[model samples]
Target: MTRMNYQSARFLTSAPTLAQCPPDDGAEVAFAGRSNAGKSSAINTLTRQKALARTSRTPGRTQLINFFTLGDDTRRRLVDLPGYGYAKVPEAVKREWQRHLADYLRGRRALRGLVLVMDVRHPLTEFDQTLLGWADDQDMPVHILLTKADKLKSGAAKSALQQVRSRLREWEDLVTVQLFSSLKREGVDEACARLDAWLADPEPA
Candidate 1:
């Protein structure tokens, strides 16, 4: 497999709807989670950049689908979906975001897989399950990142990992879960390896 130089990540564009997204030219992986679930921080850590995905103290700061290209290649892209399940947002706006997110997930041909981030202490929320179910229906692979693992003790963290792993047994073939910490940079290589596999083509030019 060709190693992706994630450090070469660069902001590409932000799209409000799927219609505005870049051309569906090559494989792309999407990062998604509820608001304040450490999705942004995980992206930054994976790319080895401080502000690549724009972490915010306030939840629901990412209101658009932000795209980033790897190594000056427009074909290999990473998408940051808007953080969902934030209570402060208006009901109408929330409904619209849900529609857009669903459409993107269901219809985007270039989307190869999803990286779902969840807080280690609070894994598998209703929203997370909803997204996971959608991926399963589409036969899309998902990698769950239990972010903020550093906040828990070593034994507790291990327990949390085991619990989530066991819960994911039903979809073991399509889903994989791992403990990750943006602060400590845990599981970076594993996460990258998964992404590399997803983005790799069986027949290369």
Candidate 2:
């Protein structure tokens, strides 16, 4: 199969619940991360389109599972899951989002893999570990992007990358980590390459 031109990605639909998502017909990869972790910026940068995922100054602005299709094929999709760990949101609302997120991650058969974004300055928080554990339980592959790499100095950024890579050694075969700076457009190709690999496969094994 030819490499997908993510630049041709277009917004598909936003589903508040897994039941409302598009039919589970094709391979899909979901992007997940903590609130204000640069998930939106990384997605926009990956697709080479500004505002594709709706970046916002406020954390937790993405409150739904937003889908984007590559080219015109509905089978291939990139899902933007709601950002977690934003304390400002009400407890009831947060619980509801968490329930929906858990259900989708555990039940979505078409979900081929996951892209977990995190800030380089603060990688692997408690919530991140929880998600990783869940992925492990499902035998799902994950590619972690240490977003906002520009915020740290070169040495610090390298150290952060190595640290995360070292800590994830047990899951090395199923997990990959890379430093990414959406503002600098760094690591966009690498990130997309992983996404393409997942999408190319009929199902993640």
lDDT of each: 0.91, 0.91
Scored against the true structure, residue 99 in model 2 reaches a CA lDDT of 88
lDDT at position 124, candidate 1:
95
- Residue 83's C-alpha lDDT in candidate 2? 95
Q: Model 1 clash pairs?
A: none
lDDT of 1 at 181: 95
Candidate 1 at residue 175, lDDT? Answer: 96
Per-model TM-score, in order, reads: 0.96, 0.96
The positional error of residue 112 in candidate 1, measured at the CA in angstroms, is 0.8
- Off-target runs (Cα >4 Å) in candidate 1 are 202-205
The TM-score measured for candidate 2 stands at 0.96
Candidate 1 per-residue lDDT over residues 164-203, each given as its tens digit: 9999899999999999999999999999999999888522
